[model samples]
Target: MIYNFEDLKEIVKSKVSIKRFNHIMAVVDMSIKLAKIYNADIEKCKIAALLHDICKEMNKEEMKKICKNNFSEDLTDEDLENDEILHPFVGAYWVEKNLKIEDIEILNAIKNHTLGNKNMTLVEKIVYIADAVEITRNYPGVEEIRNLVFKDLNEGILFEAGKKEKYLESIGKKSHKNSYAMQKSIREEIKKKN
Candidate 1:
């Protein structure tokens, strides 16, 4: 079944809490802004941003069940155990299986939004950074990271990845392998630019 943007918005609203819905909206707005600036596909950004966290509110068992049922081969043991990282995988599957979204870019953006991979497309990067630095995110240094994203997308990603790594380490959580890969890839991209 084909779904329009508004259809997607309403569906997401009903699935997640009001607070999560608001965050999704903020990410959508931020994604559009970044997409315009970066020459990425705006529609893809909006769709990806809206669906990135679709499974975030789901219980761990539900998310794990989806993961086990659909793409168990693709997930690591660590991913199954980590709720923060697991939702993206389940979300990607949910959108593909339930919503009939065939676009690999959108699926990948949703899958990678939580722990970005080694090679992120423009839409992927835009959605990832937008989710992190959206308007409602009021963590320390967020404004600076937001500004840096507008200045240089790769730099913004690098900084955000660093901050995420540090935070994960502080909490005694091991950073996902994809996160490390993303940082390495972004650093190389930045080097190529300079």
Candidate 2:
């Protein structure tokens, strides 16, 4: 079904975990603004924002278990490693199998919100950008990127990913070796007009 505000609210009520729901709401608000500005699919943006982290609390082991049972075999090893990166793919599966959502756009947005795919659609970019810049977020330089999101999406995307990479380095986390997909995505987006 096409999701509007009330429908989103209902879905949130039914599907959201208590601790994460507030974050979801924050993303939803930001996503709506982005959808308006970017002329994206509003319902898909809302649904994707609402469901982006549906499996976030799952640990790597749990994620693996779920993926083993539910995931298609076409996923590569990098995709498996990145399973712990974000839960949007698992979330999409849950949202479909449990929540009865069947829209391909919504599923794609949820699937791609993290470590975004190359040549992302408007809906995918809307959710990814919105999730990064939501008000509940307090990462360094978020306000700068938040401002840039309205003015120059590609710049904001590059800046945010760069910021995240730096933050990971600072926290002594291993930075992901630049995946070929990310390189391709960066190159594709670099060519786009704001």
Candidate 3:
């Protein structure tokens, strides 16, 4: 209800494609609902969801170039290699630097949404997984995951993340699609279950 649509428009103009802005807005609305359900920080979730795909439309080549040129050495090799997934990190950087936003929590939510790190904050996990399972999204097995989110978010996030990790790995057995953070998060998630 309190979304800054004009700010969103300005932000989208620079970082996201026109088509993606609507998707991001949809995620924003869904995330707000999730925040209410999960007791997460609503403002953080909204900002994170709105800006999640800010760099989604960047051509893979351009994405790679931006990441290569600007990212700190802190990024893992897997992050460097996966341009498709690296867009979130790039979007966070641009948002921080250009938009002058200093909220690390919001930035971290956007930064790690793709390959979730271990011990993510509530807002972080909610935004990360919610973007994947928003009401409007339709992919194979998505409905089950959506139901899982309402029942148990941690289980849902881990389940989907694990599934995605496996799919990415199956894409290349030797050079698996799993990132160190993703693997770490799954183990952390299992530990929580135990």
* Top-scoring candidate (TM-score): 1
Q: Candidate 2: list runs displaced more than 4 Å.
A: 4-8, 58-61, 69-86, 172-180, 192-194
Residue-wise lDDT of candidate 2 within 46-90, one digit each (tens)? 878888887777677767666667664535456567665547768
User: Taking the tens digit of each residue's C-alpha lDDT, what string does model 3 give over 102-143?
Assistant: 788888898878767667888888888888887778888898
Give the 10-residue window scoring lowest on summed lDDT in candidate 3: 173-182
What's the count of clashing pairs in each model shown? 0, 0, 0
Instruction: Score residue 30 of candidate 2 by CA lDDT.
Output: 95
Reference-based lDDT, residue 86, model 3: 77
Q: Which residue pairs collide, candidate 1?
A: none
Residue-level lDDT of model 1, residues 151-184, one tens digit each, is: 9999998998888888888999877788888999
Off by over 4 Å in 3: 1-5, 13-15, 59-62, 69-81, 173-183, 186-194
lDDT at 150 for candidate 2?
92
Candidates 1 and 2 compared: the better one by TM-score is 1
**TM-score against truth, every candidate:** 0.94, 0.80, 0.82
Error of 3 at 56 (Å): 1.8
- Arrange candidates by TM-score, descending: 1, 3, 2
Best by lDDT: 1
